[model samples]
Target chain A: MNITSDMIYGYTDGMILCCLSEQDSYGYAINNFILEKSGFKYELKEATLYTTFRRLEKQGHVTSYWGNESSGPRRRYYSITQEGRAYLKQRIREWKEIRQLMDAFFIDKKEEETET
Target chain B: MNMEEKIILYINRAFAGSPAAEKTEEAKEALCADLLEKYRGLIEKGHSPEAAYQATISGIGDIFELVDSVTGENREKALPSSSKILPAAESFQKWGPAAVCGIFFLLWLIRFYLAPGLLFASGLPTFLLGAVLGALGMRAFLHRNRLSFAPLLPKEQRPYQLVWGGCGLLFLAALFSRRLNPALWLIPAGAVALHQVISAWIAFSASRKEEDFHE
Candidate 1:
């Protein structure tokens, strides 16, 4: 299924936190992973990603530092903080609850339609 | 332009009016690096150079929104914990003319008391000439310091204009009162000095509150 940007809007922060949870990463690397993992079905806007990074950093959900690359311009690497981990866990639990609630309603609706 | 140049150009254009502080420049550099990396990756993945460029540029989404976010972040980071007084040079430039006028008025007062006959003979002319010079200096000072006034009244305390205008009227009144009582000349000078002090205090406090609010 093609995932729309709207579908991922609310979960962008959680996704970034999850990505950083694995290891510290830069903007392009995190986005590349997201794109590849989703089989190229999702590509985030650069502006949105950077804006999210700034917001997350400001909110103390992540911390960033300049990476020492031997060649080319320096990269900004972001790592999830303890607060980010806690926030991600809370968001995951909330997401699960929302999914369960939606599934129950949709499944009941589908069964009723099929019966009719 | 080359990919790196194009990326730098785009980012710079986006953040044109923003303060060129170290953190802001670092952020711009980071963004340029990321975009260039994305472009190179696309080209390596067998995409044509033109297609890669298109993809990378399109991925930037709304440049204005990104600029707003980045600029807002910079502003928050740059907000001072306390308001800084205007620089010595600027403060002097702003107040020097008024001080000159006060001195001239005092000189006029001294002449009036010391040599009553010489008051209009030479004192009036000297005071008038000083007043003209002071007026010209004040006009230039105000013109130069207009932008520096923005932080002083972020909420728009405009009544200061009326206070200043009243001070001018008082000075005129004092000038006319020379016939009745030359000592009355001190009244306008005192009034102007009080107005200057009060207005400066108000501006300083307003600016401090503005800084505190941002903090």
Candidate 2:
């Protein structure tokens, strides 16, 4: 089944933080990387991506500076702050716990039922 | 229009009345660059120009939410002329003196026409004028105190105080000159009516501009 946007909405902030954790990147680069990494299976709207960037910046989890792109318009690049790293660490731990709980409730139970 | 022009026009329409603050301008410039890159990539991938344009436009999603994030919740400072009802405290700050003056003027009129002897003995008209001036002075003092502590008023809105101050002066002049003829009172009354009309015209034009931008 294809994943719906609703399924990924809650993780957008974490996903963005992960992107910034790798290197300082502009809007187009981050979105393109996500698209390539997902095999073009997922794409986010420009509006949503920018909104998240503003929110994260406001929360002190990210900082931005304009890139010296000589051609066309200058790009605003975002880098994760130390607080962003701490937050991402917490989110990853929580995500792992939830994944483990889901496996216990679904995969293990399904295997047991099949064996019986 | 070219693809770049089309995208810029669309963005301008979306953010018409938003402030051109430095941070906001940076975000907008960044979005424009990204969208242009995406459009170029689509064209390189053999999409028809029309299809590419449509794709780029659709990729923006609901832009109002994005603008809101840039403006934040404290939009009053960013958009002073935005159609927003004043908070109760601010409303009182603006209208309280006018209300007090209005009541006193009404009382003076009733007494002058219906109880002439008592009106003369008590000098009710003079008393009303004094009360109006006193209320206005107190308001000014309070406003000055507030300014020392906080930047409460927007620059664009300060002209309203001048409008009211001129009306108050006209009222006192009319009251003092009423001995020439009872009709002298109409001068101040006419000034009040003129002030209301001017205020309404300003509000109407502002709202029309807001609508034009949104459209």
Candidate 3:
């Protein structure tokens, strides 16, 4: 049986919050960040990305505004709010705990026991 | 059409049945811009225009569902009351006045049949009177419901209250002045029109101010 871990495929909100934590970005730019961060293995559908944006804004975790670019079409940029940062921090802590739990459950426990 | 235009056309077609509103337009514009950017990026990566267009279009999942979810969220937020009460309230709002108008018409019909001379001697068309009264009642009902139901933002509360208050004063003045000249009834009508214009203006300016702040 072929087993693979694809935990990063979901967590669209957390990925977006992480992206915005560094700097504010627009739809395409944030998706680009996700694309690159995921080693080009995952890309969000436009619908999913924008819906997450709306959801995050509604949750007061992010705020959006129009970009005042002089040379191109106006883009709506999102920035993480203070609440978003705190939410992201909590998510990261949860992710670390989950990661540890998964490694403990899925790794070669027999080999570790023999080694000890 | 150019690639940008093609993307715009696709977006327009996707959102065709959605209600035309400011937020919908914003969503459409954002989608178009993002799709075009992605398409250009694909082209830059040596993908042919057709392939890029196909890929770009494919990346947008079920746009109708997205729009529905977004608008549905707004609908939910705009009405915090129970969902069961909405359809009942809406039907009443739509048909209650209409039913009253019908009843008034029926009464007029009976009076006409029984006392045709007296009906004509009243010097006013009873049907028109009933219709006007019914319409006024419906308007007032709708106005009241709209104000009550629409959870206004803190920024808009003041202007909304002021406009409604001013309109009420104008309405009362018009009613009192009707004793002076019957034509003064037009004052209330003018007040209604003025109220709408002022409300629309306030809404427009508020949106403009938000845009400026964002920019």
Candidate 4:
């Protein structure tokens, strides 16, 4: 609750990309998946979420199709493209490298604090 | 009109002039349902309906920014401003009716007087300039991590381009004509030239909106 909204959204593009990597899913389903996975820490604004879906689809990282929903509105489902998968893999590799570097960088500070 | 209809209309112009108009409508309805829910939530929280609706519309803040980021607009913008553009790309993107007027400004005396080395140093300047542009473009694209930038495209760019292009054309014609003063033509031509940029921008934003509402 004390965290900035930026932190929540910082991970959002990746999270959604990762979810789509599994299979094609509609707007509501993707939102639900995020909510469940994060245990409510990552509930996205409805406007924010769909806007991103539109953006991602436009970028060629993902493709969307209309779903035959019988309820409120027909869902627009999205799935990742091959290009998107490559991009995601690159991001994952980069994230891992960054994380490893951070861990190494922090160890010296951690040891200093412990000794002090 | 209800919240649903209003938001759909709001996004309608996104697909302006395209054959994909109907699909754009459907997508707007589907995508803007999120806005409808927010409208309802606002009404539930005691905000007047109009106020809530306006807030939601304004908050979306140029949906195309998100569109551009995902679509690799940055990639196109960053396409290495090389001094020597390759023969392969064949410069499909250059030139317009307004470009005819830009040729006049090639008034090389200005470039020659300012930096004669620019002719010879093309590659280095291009590389350095590219690095700077790439940085700014990335920052602009990323929002760097902000929710919104104050101004949006189309609204900011389209009309501006049309006006500038129109004036540029008009002045270029006037320059060719023997009647009007070439000097007077420059100011209007310059303004129109400025507007031409806005027009191109409008086209880009419109295309972006169309991409989101794909058939």
Candidate 5:
């Protein structure tokens, strides 16, 4: 089976935090950014995206406002707060450590065993 | 129908039967706008309208979680409103009367087995004790259910209340049993058994009501 969305839901907040850290953007733009960044290999469910937006806003990690669009739908735009940036940095550092540990434990061990 | 109208129809179906609220309405609007933008993006890439609509609808995943977050309805359902009663106090309120009732019955058992004809050996006090505990238990049970906004113990529960009240009076009669045969210890014991039966009935009915609520 394919890797389901739930498997990576934990990283969604971090992804959104990173996306918003670049600049203030609306729902579609942020989702599009994630889609393009993943080389169209993945896209978020709209429900998950908005749910993360609400949760992040609740946690003081992001703030949202209605964009003043004269025509069509007025989009709700979100920006990373200073707190969100700090949180994102912390998560990145933790993830890097975890990644290196996993590589040493699994990848390096497996390569060594195969060689021996 | 046009793309926008098709999307709206799909959204309506998705949110069908959800409670109408300001927050939910806002979420619906935001979701509609986001999906519309996505559908258009898909369309621009040369997908047919039907394919775009199918893709857009499927990409929505489960929308109820979003609804639950925005409305906070699920949170309220999952937890008792802390503002109304502290968790520790609420738990105490729920179990205190039953515990007291159990203790009184336990004391009566010890009295009957360990010491016959001891102080207050007629077991009249036992009946009165059961009556008072029965009343207290009823009040506490009703209060706990009320905290969760359960419908007032409906007409069906009336029979249980009446039976419980009858248990109280039986114990009240035990208060006078000292003037008669002491073998009437059997009366207090019977009333205690009836009290347990009534409590079990109430508990069973309460659990049934909760099942109905979940359904």
Candidate 6:
């Protein structure tokens, strides 16, 4: 609830891709990973999740294949692409840079507090 | 359709009837297997079947938004060099082969009638064969691994099946005209057009749906 929606949407695809890079996964598995990792703090709607899958696939960040299940229809399993790995690396750098920038600005408040 | 069923329907709509045999089935099987497993787990955890399915679906997300963002959706684009300027290049992208074949077909009709047996050794059916083979070859080209424009084309190319397929049937009818009367050929032609037009309309309508991916 405290997190800005923008921040969540922006990073979701990258997070999903990074998760998929570890191994191929389907939509639900990916969602669960996000939930478990965030300690149930962050969850994406199914619509948002598939859109990220589509976006990543479109961007050459991931590829999906179908596998037969014991019951019901086949599942579409997605995996990270080489380009996706490179993209995740870039996003990681950008996220770190943003974190450091925010930390610097927020900590600067302490310096000004003493001066005042 | 129920939530789970709806998901299956969409996946089939996307990957079924692809140019290659294995490609569509492969896509369908993978999506179905994982989605169903997830659905099963939710049901086991004390959720109503429908609610569980809904929750699972709500978590998966919108495909068009994904496709649009994936390929970077653009404003209406016209097929190049056409003063007639048919709207919807994205739409045309699907039927590209048919439209191309249509032009060639019309040309061939003229040639076959005006210059009957011009390529006397191979005959008209040979040209038709060439068209079918050409379409097949192009399908092979389009679906080839390390596909030239993989990311852009995969999601976008699916809608074209009806178009290419229509042209193919038309070409086949024309090829086998001697075996079957010219009148019988129109059945397939009408069927082809009906299918492509309807499919094109559906795909185009879906294209207009809200991408719904915030930020």
What DockQ results do all the predictions give, each relative to the true complex?
0.56, 0.69, 0.37, 0.14, 0.62, 0.35
TM-scores for all predictions: 0.60, 0.65, 0.59, 0.43, 0.58, 0.46
Docking class of 3: acceptable
Worst 10 residues of 6 chain B by lDDT: B70-79
lDDT of 5 by residue, A47-85 (tens): 899899988988999998878878766688898999999
A108 Cα displacement, candidate 2 (Å): 4.7
Q: Return whichever of 1 and 4 wins on lDDT.
A: 1
Distance from true location, Cα of A44 in model 3, Å: 0.6
lDDT of candidate 3 over B1-215, digit per residue (tens): 56666777788767765645678788877777788889999999999998998999988976876788666765666563433355776767755765676677667666755766665543235544644766666565556455443434354456656666776656545544536457566656766786788778977997897567446
Candidate 1 off by > 4 Å: A112-116, B82-215
Please identify which of the two predictions, 4 or 5, would achieve the higher lDDT against the true structure.
5
Q: Using TM-score as the measure, which candidate wins?
A: 2
Cα displacement (Å) at residue B104, model 4: 14
**How do the residues B49-86 of candidate 2 rate in per-residue lDDT, one tens digit apiece?**
88998999898888888888876744645444313587
In model 1 chain A, where is the ten-residue run with the lowest total lDDT?
A32-41
lDDT (Cα atoms) of all candidates against the true structure: 0.79, 0.77, 0.75, 0.62, 0.76, 0.65
TM-score of chain A of 4: 0.80
Q: Report candidate 4's fraction of native contacts.
A: 0.16
- Lowest lDDT 10-residue stretch of candidate 5 chain A: A1-10
Error of 1 at A78 (Å): 0.7
Instruction: Output the lDDT of residue B129, model 5.
Output: 59
lDDT at position B157, candidate 3: 56
Ranking by DockQ: 2, 5, 1, 3, 6, 4
Distance from true location, Cα of A68 in model 3, Å: 1.4
Each candidate's fnat, in order?
0.82, 0.91, 0.55, 0.16, 0.73, 0.77
lDDT of 2 at A15: 87
